[model samples]
Target: MARPHDAPSARELVAAVREFLERDVLGGLEGRARFHGLVAVNVLGMVERELDLGPAHERAHAERLAALGFDGDAALAAALREGRLDDRFAEVKAALEDAVRDKLAVADPSRAG
Candidate 1:
C-alpha cells in the first residue's frame, strides 16, 4: 500500500540528510566535529531502519509476548521477576531472545546480524 504522504517521506528525508552529512559535512570536519557528524549519520541510519522495521517488529513482539502467555513487556517482566515462568524458563528465554533480536534489528542492524 502507498504511504499516506507525498514524495520524500520521513525516511527518505532522513536518509538524504544522512548521506549529505557523510559525503559533504564529515569530509570537511576534524576531531570532535567529525565524530559528531558520524554519530549523526549513524543515528539517522537507525531512524531509517526503525521506520522500515517498526511495524513488523511490533507484530512479532506481540506474537512473542502472546506465546509466553503475556500481553505486554511489563507483564512479562513481572512474571519473570515473580518466578511465575520458572517452569518455562527455556521457552521464556527463547521468546526474550527473539524480542531482543527484533529490537536490535532496528536499533543497530550491524550488531543485530
Candidate 2:
C-alpha cells in the first residue's frame, strides 16, 4: 500500500529492520541495553501493526459513527455529556466498547483479546 516510489514496502522494510534488531543488535547485548532493544523491537512491531490495520480501522470507525448518527468522537461525547443519549446508553456503551476494542486490536492484538 505504498506509492510507486516505495520499494520493498513500508511494512516489509519495518519488519526487516525489526528482525535485524532482534537478531543482530539484541544478540550481543545484556542488561538495560537488551531491555531497550526489546522496547525498540516492540515499537517497531506497533508501527508495522499500525501500517497494516490503520486503514481498515479508520473505515470501520467512520462506519460505526455514521451508523450511530454521530459525526465523530467529539460529537458522541457531547451527546453523552448532555444526556442526549441517556435513553440509549446501552447501545452507546456497546458501540464505544467496540470502537475501543477495534483500536486495541491495532495497537496490540494480544492485549485486545
Candidate 3:
C-alpha cells in the first residue's frame, strides 16, 4: 500500500529536540553557551536536510521557478557568484536567511565545526 504519511511527526521531534537542546545540553553550560549550542543543533538538523538534497534539487527548483517567470536564474547566478562566507556564527545564519529568502536551499557547508 502507498503511504501518504510515514515519516516521524515534526511535533514529536521538535518537542524532543527542544527538550534535549534546552534541558540536557543546557544543563551544564552557562546561559549564553547553552543558548548558542541549542540554536546550533536546532539549525543543524534543518540545514542538514537541505544540504543533503543539494544540486539536483537546486536545478529542479531553478527550472520550475524560471518556468514560472520568477527570478530563480538571477538568484542562482548570485549564489554562484557569491563568495565563500567568513567563519562566524552570525555569518552562518545570514547565509541561511539569504538563501531562503532567495528561494534557494542553504546547506551548512560546515556542520558543527
Question: What is candidate 3's lDDT per residue for 1-113, written digit by digit as tens?
Answer: 76576665554565567667766887788788978987777676555555455566677655554543356556544544564323343644554454464343344434322
Kindly list the per-residue Cα lDDT of model 1 for residues 1-113, writing each as its tens digit: 98799998998999999999988899899999989998999999989999999999999889999988889999998998999999998898888788788778878887786
Kindly report the root-mean-square deviation of model 1 from the true structure over all alpha carbons. 1.2
Extract clashing residue pairs from model 1: none
Off by over 4 Å in 3: 1-25, 69-72, 75-113
lDDT by residue for model 2 (1-113), tens: 54886578889999999999998899898999999999999899989988998899889888888878998989988988999989987878888888898778867789787
Stretch of 10 with least lDDT, candidate 1: 104-113
Most lDDT-accurate candidate: 1
User: Candidate 2, which segments miss by more than 4 Å at Cα?
Assistant: none
Clashing residue pairs in candidate 3 are: none
Candidates ranked, most accurate by lDDT first: 1, 2, 3
Clashing pairs for model 2 are none
Better candidate by lDDT, 1 or 3: 1
